[model samples]
Target: MRKIKELGEFGLIHKLSSQINFRASDSILGIGDDCAAYPVKSGKFEVISTDALVEDIHFKLSTIKPETLGRKALSVSLSDIAAMGGTPKRIMVTLGIPKKISVSFLEKLYSGFNEICNHFKVELCGGDTVSSPKCFFINVAVIGEAKRIFSRKGAKPGDLVFVTGTLGDSSLGLKLLAKNKTRGKDHKFLTTKHMDPTPRVKEAEILGRSKIDITSMIDISDGLVQDLHHICESSNVGAQIYEDRLPLSPELIRTCKRSSIPPLPLVLNGGEDYELLFTLPADGVKNLIRQFLKAKVLVTQIGKILKPGGISMKMKNGTLKVLPESEGFNHF
Candidate 1:
């Protein structure tokens, strides 16, 4: 008999997912991709995904406000829809409320939810609320529609890997918040990034509508290297990312310099960036840049797909170092 820790997060997921033998024909996608897609009469696939945020693990009550938490709770799940090249339509929130929570907190939380929903034009459907013994948590389910769907299984050796926005800022912000150093002017932007992450819904929509052939996609919720590994695993291809090609915000670089820590670790291994990590044909790079530029979204080419079997990083010294799958956060 094997324990869960021995199997690891992906192993456990594979184990459980393999046992689900009752998938229907209408359910074209399930378990493996960011969201499960079902074809509908509207000439689109209805994609659905859910994510849970727990106290201490996902956030600290002392660090984040209830409203910030609420927006983030939904944002995380929305990223999944974006990964599937979908637009968010409706959302449902399930709360594990502790006795220590107040009505004001819940009200502020809903206000945050309403603000985002208005911007995205998403409907606020009903959900369940339950009392908890101690720690509070939130589970958000988002339903979306995609005219053209993307999955993790499409990357080829010639695909060029791209990532949206800057990496490492959010994770570094979380680190700074833990030490209560999030008050200064320099820390403000990074800290806010850690709290309020924007799901790349519009950007994904642009890609889906564009002529570019986006081979594979996943959001950077679990770190760049870790999430990119998912693409490699699914597509049966390898990747080689250049350290210098990784996009980093000035604030993240300065913060790393000030703290005397390396930025690469945070950029490659830290989680909760919520940006899009995707792959497309090398020929489509020009068009991808043009489309995202008009939208004012930054998409950086950090790597390339290979025919081999492992993920590697090209150092500044021009050495290729293999990155272990254990680089990212393990939920277990």
Candidate 2:
């Protein structure tokens, strides 16, 4: 038998998912997608997705407050619905509580959940709570519907790649937290990026309902290059990213200078940005920009889909280099 690390997270998913069978007639999509979908009624498909966050593994309780952690727990899961261009209707949460956790912490966590739920107009439908010998973890599931679902597949040769918001901020934030250097304006911005990530639900809804056709879509939860690779593999296409074009915040650049860290590596490989990475034909670029700007969301074109081959990047120095997606975060 092959070990889990040998297959890696995505590969393990592919291996096990292949053996599983689905008999549900309404099921339009299954494993290997951001969300599973099935047609509900009148051209809409109900999409569902779930994710788990564990103490120490996914986050450090020492660095994050219960309220912010609670908000992030739901926001991360909701990003899946956004990737499929769906609006969230409801959510369910499951908790694995260890003896060390306090009742007040749980209450504040749920309070955070209630606040975000109200903001998104999603109901807390159902869930379960269980005791664990060690490790506190949370699993959040969301259900939503979409008129049109954008999947990883569908990129054609000439499709332009775009990403919402800046990249690498969250990754930098994680590094800062890990080092116990949580001070300064730059640190605060980056730390907030990691702790309180915003799911681009509104942006996704507008793009999905707009006239511009989005060929492929996924959220950058696993780094920009890794998520883009998912779209490429599913579409049976490749891509070429422009390094300078990749979005970066002034805070990120300045903070990296202070820390003596290279920003590009973090931008390409850091996870938990939670921004949407998408593609459309070159012609759709203009209108997409206008739509995004009106919504006050920054959408920048950073790459282009190429004929089936390896994924590469054009550096600021004008050299092209093939990128290895394995450098990204993987559970295995």
Candidate 3:
């Protein structure tokens, strides 16, 4: 057998999925979907999503504490719920820890999880703990409720696309952390961004309740270009993002200047932002902007959905160019 690295993450998933023979059932829409579907007796639908965080791959133990790890594990699952325009109600977390990890470290991790759950009103249901052979791994499954669910396939042409908050801070933070470690320069904002990320749960709730007729929604876990490409591919539509409209944080700009790197690429292609990227009807753009403004999050109008095709970026010089296809954060 070849090494997992040779196959890459998505390739390995495809390889494994090809080997499995799934039995057909009324409840199971398994394998490729973002969240698995199962029948619920109640009138309302129930959703379950899980995400795993492993040491070294997702985070470095030297920089990220156990508590942050636990909180982030829960947040990533919650982001999936947000993508579906659902409210998270409950979560179950399973931990794989090395034997050398202390009880106190685990307690702090649970405390962080509890804090986030309390903030979101999500209950910690149940989970299992196991011993890892080497490093730590945390997985969280979130259960959510929705009256009308949002899917990636719902977008249409002429829909206006928007994103919550600024982009590239997280990626710039990672760069700053690496630079600081190597050059002994202290950059607090960048370091904080790498350690802690805010999930746009409130924004998701507001957008869900506004009844603004959103066509589709997604969380930017991967780079903006890649994540938007998901919606484009699923909905069978193309997109044209205005390069000038991309929102870059001041911190990101300053850091980019300091590092002598162009901020535009980082803003466009960086991942782990955890911000909401969604599309709404062209008619409802004003109302949506007002709603988000009241929530104090600046929503940037980056682009519009087009007829089914490839993605293009309108450069500052007013030229359109096709966006190259690329994968983001491939885990093997």
Query: Which tens-of-lDDT digit does each residue in 1-332 have in candidate 1?
Result: 56544555455445433432334345555555555555565788889898999999999998888888878888888899999999987776677877677656766677678667777777555455676789999998888899999999899998899999999988899889988897676699999888989999999999999989998999988899899999999999999999999999999988899989799999999988999999998889889999989999899999999996899999999998999888898898
Question: Per-candidate TM vs. native?
Answer: 0.87, 0.87, 0.84
Poorest 10 consecutive residues by lDDT, candidate 1: 16-25
TM-score-wise, the better of 1 and 3 is 1
Locate the minimum summed-lDDT window of 10 residues in model 2.
Answer: 15-24
Each model's C-alpha lDDT?
0.84, 0.86, 0.76
- Judging by lDDT, tell me the better candidate of 1 and 2: 2
Better of 2 and 3 by lDDT: 2
Q: Write the per-residue lDDT of candidate 3 for residues 143-213, one digit (tens) a residue.
A: 88876677788889999999988888888778766655423233566566656777787888888788799
Clashing pairs in model 3? none
Could you tell which candidate, 2 or 3, scores higher by TM-score? 2
What tens digits encode model 2's per-residue C-alpha lDDT throughout 73-190? Answer: 9999889999999998767677887767765676668777877777787656556567779999999988888988989999999999999999999999999999998899999999
Estimate the lDDT of model 1.
Answer: 0.84
